[model samples]
Each structure stands twice: as structure tokens, then as C-alpha cells.
Target: MGSCEVYPQTIQHSPNGRFVVVCGDGEYIIYTAMALRNKSYGSAQEFVWAHDSSQYAIREGNSVVKIFKNFKEKKTFKPGFGADCIFGGFLLGVRSNSGLAFYGWETSDLIRRVEILPKHIFWSDSGELVCIATEESFFVLRFLMERVTTAQESREMLTEDGIEDAFEVLGEVQEVVKTGLWVGDCFIYTSSVNRLNYYVGGEIITIAHLDRTMYLLGYIPKDDRLYLGDKELNIISYSLLLSVLEYETAVMRKDFNTADRVLPTIPLEQRTRPLSVMLFKNNCLISVLLNYLTRLSILLQFSGEQIV
Candidate 1:
């Protein structure tokens, strides 16, 4: 509804939606998104927001990196040698020669290092897990943020190696993840094959194969739906559930104990799709037939016709 003093080349809103930034002509302004007041300003070649959106980084003067907390400059330093890219979040991430290395925002000390080729990094809303999308695949990791942050704040003793203990790479999925979002322990992504899938505990299960490129925008737990935007900018949504995701993951892993336990706990109406997904997985002919029968029974139950 208004114009800016400087025409913006790019505009980005924080993940938290509290702040908005506009960059143009090597200068930037951070504004309170609602009231549109300029709270922070600086000159930098690049501007990147952190995971929580409370902090951000700006690259200026060659290798120099600056971090701003709550719209105020907090720290400035140089990324270590072999580091090529900067990603600010729960930690200051730099792509190094071997892998990704994280540093504390205040002390700039090494928090942990991960060995992987990362093209994009997505941290979960809860900040407990992170998904690193590589050239051809994607992987997840458990970041011990509390532990690492405590070590930084208390200056506690670390092992001689000092890292290795702070993070664990869960595993990688070779699916070409185009774009995705994380909800709790599940990662919902659209693949290169035009399929929507969710990953959990190293296994992936298909949700649908709509032949359109979709980007995950948000998930509403109360309504049990995911809002997505397609290439044409049309908004679409689909029903999803966390319990169903967990049950399907357990089933894909062939953990019958877990699958059987979680199956009945799912809302009755949502049970069919989870089982239908398994029918096409790597299961054999006999398993497929059995799953087929199970689907029929679920349908009958849905129609209020009990299976005799």
C-alpha cells in the first residue's frame, strides 16, 4: 500500500514473521513487518536470516561476517579457511572443506562439525532435527543444541576432540528433495518424481503423486492439513496426520510390533491411506494381497459395515 525510499531488489520475511528485510544497491533495511518501521540498517553483499529469525548474518568487506541479534549488531569475525558459504541459525554454519561446521554466535567457538555435501539446510520448527539436502539426496541429523549451547555458556570441559559427541547423522535418503518442511519427527517433501512423501527414521512413504511442483508453506496440526503453493502460485492443501506418519514409518521399517501398536491408535478414518501406501512399497505379491484385503476391511468399517 506504500512505496519505499529505495527500490528493493529483494524482500525477505523472517521465519517467525516478525521482521522483514529489503536489500538493494549493497544496502539493506530490517523492518518490523507489521508496523514497517526501520529498526536495523547496514551495507552488505548478502543478507541471510537465522533459523529462529531472531538473528541474521551479513557478509561484507571480503571474508568478514557479521551477526545481528534482535536487530542489533552482536558479533563480527571471519569464517575459517576452507569455508565457502554462511548459514546462520541455532548456530553459525559454514560449509568447510570437509563438511559443515557450526560455531557459537557469541564466542564463535566450534560447536560441532558434520561431514556431508550440503546444498541446502532445513532445520525443524522445534530445532531438534535438521535436514541437509545434498546434490542428489537428503539427510537428517539430531543436533544436541541444548548440550552444545550449555557448553558454550558454562565453558564446560569438552573431550580432546571437542566435537564428535554433539551431533549424530541419522541417515540419508537418496530422493531428490526439491523442497520440503519438517513437522516434529517427520519431513514432508516433494520429490523430483512429482511425488509427495514423508520421511521418518530412514524410511520414506508416499502420500500422493500429484504431477505438479509444490512448495510446502505450513502445517496446521489442529486441522491436520498441509498448505502448499504450486508453480502457478495456486494454494493447495492436503490432509495429514503425525500419528499416521509414525505408524507408516514403523510399517516401512518392518517393525510389526510398532506398526500393530500404532495402527489402532490412528483415527479410524485416516487408517486406510497409510495401509494403502504400504501395498505398493517393496512388499511381495502375498504381502500386497494381504494389504489389499486389509484395505477392503477398512473401507467396510468406514461405511459402518463390520467385518464378520
Candidate 2:
């Protein structure tokens, strides 16, 4: 096989057989289970790759850590100003800004400690000891290691001006009233002054007028579905873009005009209130927390027999 060339601004690999490389400009590569199963490329902006590559992690400014047989990106163990190191099946991490934060592969949540250790660090698949540096020399240890083989995939082409056509809308959005528009698995969710609308397949179907009572808080898309969470702890789940209007009317016909109040929710007491939505386990809906917040959050899973 021809050796693949990757211009990763930052690169990392784990001994367990997984790879995570991020372009300095803002692109990421992940070796996922499905990518390995089909022997294809797995690099979607969304964290929907299949589990089995041995390590689960992503690199933004900070890394989101996940470990499981199945690829569910929700088990982000440590967030915020800290470092991590893993070796011999033992995962370790340190926290900061106030509190003890430590964890491993066994526990779903992280534990905090009183003292900090400088030597306990995680190793990468290349047998290289890697640690995040704050200034020029002081290294904070964080990040477990895994190994993964990569198959080159087509990437977005950028123009000479260092811009992509996809991001052009951002300029237009800023011209407006700072409105937000997002694409979901099955529909599009948008927010403007006092109004929330849902569109499926390019057609407007559902409309909610907040009337200055409440503001739109967040939305999450997953597996051809979208979950909307508002400021009032109301979580409304919608599937199939064409079905959004019908679903909302049926669920809130009695109080559609008034602000949402009686909706069920995934617990968010331990973490900061979510201002945005992200895809969780099995394409389920969940709120996105700040990268460094100490909160109680878990990947919401679907229990249907059809789920893989």
C-alpha cells in the first residue's frame, strides 16, 4: 500500500490501535469501528463513528475522551484545564481551577483529588509520552493512547483565500440580527426574535412564537432526529423532518402558544445549563456542556431492539 500523507497540525496515536489527528486549521481524523469494519474512511465532523478502533477521543482545543465497545461520543471523562495519561489499561487524568478530577476506563464519571502529580502521564500508540504544555516547559499530563490504521478520504476543497463556500453563510448571518440556523438529521431548527421554526426537506411546518416570554436555549440532532431544549428545562424530541410540525402540534396543542413547561428532560442539574445541543449515544439527544464544567452527564441511549 502507498504511504498516505496527512498534513496533521497535531497528531496522536494510542497503542490500542486508534488514531486521532487534527489539522491546525480546523479539521479532524478519527479511526472508528465502522471505518475498520468496512475498511473505509471515518471522518465526519459529527462524532458518529463506530466503536472498535481501541481508543475514543477527539481533539478540539481540548480532547473529549470516550471508552467503550461501541462508539458513543458522550462519555467525555475530563473537560477543562487539565492533562491526562493512560498506560497498562489504567487511565488517569488531573483537573484544575478548583476540584479533584481523576478517572479510568472502569468508571463512567471522573473523580477529583487533592494533589497533582507531574509524572503520571498517558502514552500514545507510538510509545511516545505526550503531555499538554501550558507555557514553554511545564507539562500537564492528560490523554490516553490508542492505535488506528487510516484510509485516505476526500476532504473539503478550500479556495485560495483560505475560505470554504460552506462557511459563507456565516457572513450573511452576521448581517442579520444574530439569528441562528442549524441542520438536524431530519430537519432544520432556527431561532430569531421571539420565534422558533422547524423545517423539513425545505418546507416550513412548525412555528412557535415565544412572544418575549422565553428564549430558545439549544437544539441537538441525532440519527435522523432532532431534540430541542429550551430555557425552561423542556426537552422536545422530533424525528423525520417532515414529521416535526405534526409532532409538535400533537404534543403541545393545548399550550402551543404559551411557553413550554411540561416537557420531560434528561438530568442537567450537576452540569451547567446547556446552551447548545450535541449528538449523544446512538444518535440520541443531549445538551452540550462547557468543555471544563464538572457536571453529571451521560450518553442517552435508545433501548429499542433495532439499535446496534
Best by lDDT: 1
Q: Runs in model 1 with CA error above 4 Å?
A: 4-10, 96-98, 146-162, 246-265, 272-308
How well does candidate 1 score on lDDT at residue 177? 82
- Candidate 1 has a TM-score of 0.76
Model 1, residue 115: what's the lDDT? Answer: 69
| Per-model TM against the reference | 0.76, 0.26
Candidate 1: pairs in clash = none
lDDT string for model 1 (77-170, tens) is 8865455666755667777566877777667777776666677777777777888888899888888866775765666646433465577789
- Taken over the whole model, the C-alpha lDDT of each candidate is 0.73, 0.32
Lowest summed lDDT across 10 adjacent residues in model 1 is found at 284-293
**Model 2: per-residue lDDT, tens digit, 143-244?**
222211111112333222211221111001111112233332122333345445442222233355554433333344334344555567676644433233
- Model 2 residue runs over 4 Å out of place are 1-6, 17-23, 31-53, 59-70, 77-89, 92-100, 112-308
